[model samples]
Target: MNRIALLAASAAGLAVYAIAPAHAAVLPTDATETVTSCGNSRLQAGLATRVCAEITGTTVEFYGRVGLAGPPSPGGPAPAPRELLTTLSVEVAGAAAPRTQFTSALFTASNLEVRGTADTVPCGSTVRATFGVASYPYAANPVVHEVTVTC
Candidate 1:
């Protein structure tokens, strides 16, 4: 009886070890959540939320939101679709341009549009922007990386 009990316990422990995962896990959000709202936030029926991301780079920042603003009434079906609002704001960090390096050009020039550029920018740093939906229409939620800015 004693031997049987010990065998059962060992087998149970082995089973548990076998079932356990070999590695630490990574969550979907960790890689998927970009600065963009649509790319970062989960979509549901008739939901509207805004997300803003700030990047310090010479490249342009394109913005968009995720999910449709929900239905009109609590009991009613979902409302009409909401369109994306996309825009770009230029960011600068240090030393006024014309003399400032690309990384330190925090002040907004002609195309760049941003407020409080002086306060937000740090000295001597370059910024580039990139954005996209990793999962796209399917919603895989991939990470957004830097893309070179054009003149």
Candidate 2:
């Protein structure tokens, strides 16, 4: 009986090991771009926003979210909480002009009506922009995101 239990345990362990992945999924590096949301407490008052990035080969796309607060009650001290209002997705493409050495490339999205700069670093790249809403009260100021990628 003891031998049978030991055999069962061994088989189970082997099965688990076999099912497990040999290695974790590695983030793309070569000619790839990544973007992330830089959360800000000041923007959290009546608005919420997030940024996301997708990279395929040498192309990179960015996404943004905008949120707004709900209405406040009559004579209430606090206003209603904020909620997601909309989302914006834009593809960033290099400009026609040559990029200066050690300077970031210029990218823009005419459809979304936004522009930003991207710079390469040792292991990855960083992006900084205001999502073209800096004048808006709820707009986040100079939102930044970074991702690791091979040059």
What TM-score would each prediction reach against the true structure? 0.23, 0.34
lDDT of 2: 0.37
Query: Relative to the unseen true structure, what is the C-alpha lDDT of residue 37 in candidate 2, on a scale of 0 to 100?
Result: 30
lDDT of 1 by residue, 27-116 (tens): 112222322211233332223322233333322233423344333576776443333222223323233542211211211111222111
- Candidate 2 lDDT over 122-149, as tens digits, reads 4343322223223224542433333333
Candidate 1 regions off by >4 Å?
1-49, 52-63, 67-72, 95-151
* Cα lDDT, all candidates: 0.31, 0.37
As a TM-score, model 1 comes out at 0.23
lDDT: worst 10-residue window of model 1: 100-109
Best by lDDT: 2
Tell how far residue 124 is off in model 2, in angstroms: 5.5
Flag clash pairs in model 2: 29-149, 29-150
